[model samples]
Target: MGRRKPNETMRLLVATFIGIVLGFFLGVSFPTLSLTKLNLPSSLFPSIDLTYIEDKYSGLSTQALLNAWSSLQGKDGSAAEINEFNESRIWVPTNPRGAERLPPGIIASESDFYLRRLWGSPDEDLKMRPKYLVTFTVGYEQRKNIDAAIKKFSEDFTIVLFHYDGRTTEWDEYEWSKNAIHISAPKQTKWWYAKRFLHPDIVAAYDYIFIWDEDLGVEHFNAEKYLRLVKKHGLEISQPGLEPNNGLTWQMTKRREDSEVHKDTEEKPGWCSDPHLPPCAGFVEIMAPVFSRNAWRCVWHMIQNDLVHGWGLDFALRRCVEPAHEKIGVVDAQWIVHQSVPSLGNQVRPKALIALGLSFIDMVFTSLSFKSCQGKAESGKAPWEGVRERCRKEWRMFQERMSSAERAYYVSLGIDPPNSTTAR
Candidate 1:
């Protein structure tokens, strides 16, 4: 309880001043120094590195660090993941508006094909953007059919062509082909072309997307009228009904003389598990399907990058729209004939051709000659056969992938997947 003398108080004040000066020098010399790293006992000394955790994850954004921390603690990272609508998730160091990454010019914009003039203002460059997008996966052999199909669509639609024959200049003979967007890749299927070229964001401005095969006969179809009828029925996914007599696989997609639109039909007994499912309802053949913007966005994501044939996609299209039986249907009033030309199917080399022992050049010439003559293989055992067999294999593969993916997703949520019998 006794008070200290002048000499003791002076010594204590000098020691405190020296300690403060030494601490400042140490901070400047080793900014990263931390009491935690030195194995110091926390009970003996006050914790000096308040930002140890922050410095450990210095380069990570706050959201990313939170996600990692949650994962380490056995928590669902999804809870800490960025929400789609959270504007603060964006980060731009130079932005005047905090968390706004995209500049005005770089903000979301729809893609278009209108040629802009170098001298004109961008506003005046395009009088109007096309409202619909029509794409055809074609071969030069089907030029006439494709020309006829393009004639059915009005100027309000943008024409895009995916040529599998490596022939673009030859299409210039058709007046509309000059204005059309042409992409050439030899021997690629329609779905392959679609997956690469028709990204949902790229075609977001269009109200509808028409992805059709070049073999379709559009003599009875009118694009504008078809769209009008589609909108009237609130159809988000549709296809012009195939002429009932030709190349019809599903009863749901077959043209009905009695109705303008058909969403459901009585298919063969066990083909569909539910009357509201595919081959009975909510179905459209991939050959000539049309999709609304929102539906296409979902469908685009559903498309498997490697599944070029799109065999099982017809059944899965129902998942993109609600009340599948209501929003998916066939426009019976606007019917098209599926010619089943098998142009791409003919790309397969027949066993007979291989057995002939002809040189590669000779085989090429012989194949071209055979294709010119209706492209049918002898005894149904060649070209088209191989293609058809491959399609069946792809269908099985696609179904397995979808089932596995669904099962994995359910497992991740700690839930058992429903039985196949009850899954429908």
Candidate 2:
């Protein structure tokens, strides 16, 4: 059987060689007259198909494009992955056949209450969007003062309350509160809430933003009149001038009895290095600062999330607006009295108020940090004192951060900052 097998293999090899020679001779004889062109049997020699490859890579096949897209999105290349990718990017364009039609680009960045409708004519849903937004970082203890301030604002203003005491439902007793937005976080400050909730994109619909403390008395202040003067003066960042005899701090922010508005004032000797700089000209306290939309966009980005007290932010307000002395000022015609009522500093819990028996020196050392008084018996140091100390620490930290950031930015540009020792 083995001998017969070897003889059969040899015979097959000879036949294959003869067939190949005959085919090569036939191809040489008639190069153009090939198997595909000839009327040959259908199954004798299957034709090589290039149609699929040509059609698939012609431009870009749908499946190939989808596979590339899935890879770009870091998804497994599968039919399910393609569907998920499309779902995830519903607002963006992907395919011409099933691409989503989008609204105006401006409308995408600007938002309002238009989407909150249950049922209404889409065109008539918002007859008028508020031009201004006023936000108060408040606790329930100051509800009366908050109500008074709310009354001073017209319907053209949108009211937002950041509840530090975790009290929100009680404010709803007022009719206006039902329409206002309420954000509650226990023992948090306005800057903390603003950094999280009042993002530039979230409040982009408003023309101006009023970030005020809860203790202000807005008795003489009229929102409409304030904005009118703000526009007239081209004030990109401002505040209702502090009543001269009230909780006034900076001379630049004190209201003048005779003027419609005041841009500059003579501060205490040595308080201001430049007449055009802060405390003398371009200054507004953080207590009741108003920011134009463009200015707030810049200011919002500048807010440090951890600097909850916002102690040094008043000094940095000038950074958000150009020609700071000219564009930042106090509106005297519409002024608010800083009530100076304690709100945040005294918000310690009953357990936290227990007096610590530590000595004066110990209290002094403990006062340098916010959490230093948590359990230590620091004699003569009140809970509010610890809070105040934290405020001071945060102020120093903010100043250092700004200086360091400025130095680093200058170094990145391969230049030294003005007045820097490195520059010399």
Candidate 3:
């Protein structure tokens, strides 16, 4: 090629720069001025903003833009649309961690997805037809009680065992144990498992939830019949009436033959403030209470991680439902024996025992009292005075912890705890 005159070359360069500037201005003024915003097929310009292209394309994705581009060029729009949708599919990313917008904490964790796959499909017949759901927080020591509790439920119910005390595989030694889903983590309380796995929404398909202690004697408790009574009475939060002879059983839980369900019980003098309040009204011991699907959604959040024993939760259970004196109650016709034997309390290792500054007896009392016993400890302590003192101390600390947590949760929700009268 022959070299042009210097003046001509300079003039050509100036004209080219003006044209580039004009193109840039046009691109900014309109959405579809550039090839980058065309099909977006090559992914070479993935950063290109298709949303800025036109008013009609404002909400259309890059893939949608590609579909339009492909259609304009007489290509199949369906193929392009499929490719775009596939590109937007969300997946767990462990490696390029922040590469995608992750699911929030309230949603199921990524681990739950993978853990579910390993569990294979649920029982085919019970797939979505679980009439009831039962969760038992248990240890190897209460094997008998746990077995009895399972027998009360019909096969239509889905049974899940939350094994604490670190003996995860011990239950596998037995044949029947293999039938129920066993989720084990050392020292995790029943409420802990419930928080993570049994969120109310997760079990919405079930008609009722029986969150029970491992030691309930179901000699007279019929799961299906109890559910019938719950439905008939419209009881949202309830427990089977306790056999009056069951040692350590509260008077309110005692079964009365006259009625099918009862919401209030006579309390000891000076023990309760209102006749229509829990212990007196709307109360079910945490050990054997059953919750309907909708009610549990509220109660689940009320449970605190640190207060795994659920000590004060029974009193607060009324908060989840209205007319605490009416909606929550006890099914007198179907009662369970609160077997007081506490095996997990005495089953701790030497290492944990020394670290907690608890003697074997204290551990037994603490475990059964704190997070140890769900319904009632298998047996009451000798010298009820000693057990009473421990309970008083534990309960005091528990209330403090819950109060602090309540304040923090409210603050997170942008409310002043002291000023806000509503529960979190």
Candidate 1 vs candidate 2: the lDDT winner is 1
User: In model 1, what is the error at residue 98, expressed in angstroms?
Assistant: 16
Q: Once superposed on the true structure, which residue ranges of model 2 sit more than 4 Å away at CA?
A: 1-107, 113-115, 345-380, 420-424
The lDDT values for all models are 0.76, 0.73, 0.69
Task: Looking at model 1, report the run of 10 residues with the lowest lDDT sum.
Answer: 367-376
Q: For residues 93-155, write the lDDT of model 1, one tens digit per residue.
A: 454433245565565445665557788677887777889999997788788888888999999
Model 2 earns a TM-score of 0.69
Give the candidate number with the greatest TM-score.
Answer: 1
TM-score of each: 0.70, 0.69, 0.61
Give lDDT: candidate 1, residue 343.
65
lDDT of 2: 0.73
Q: Pairs clashing in candidate 1?
A: none
Candidate 1 lDDT for residue 355: 82
After best superposition, candidate 1 residue 114: deviation in angstroms? 3.3
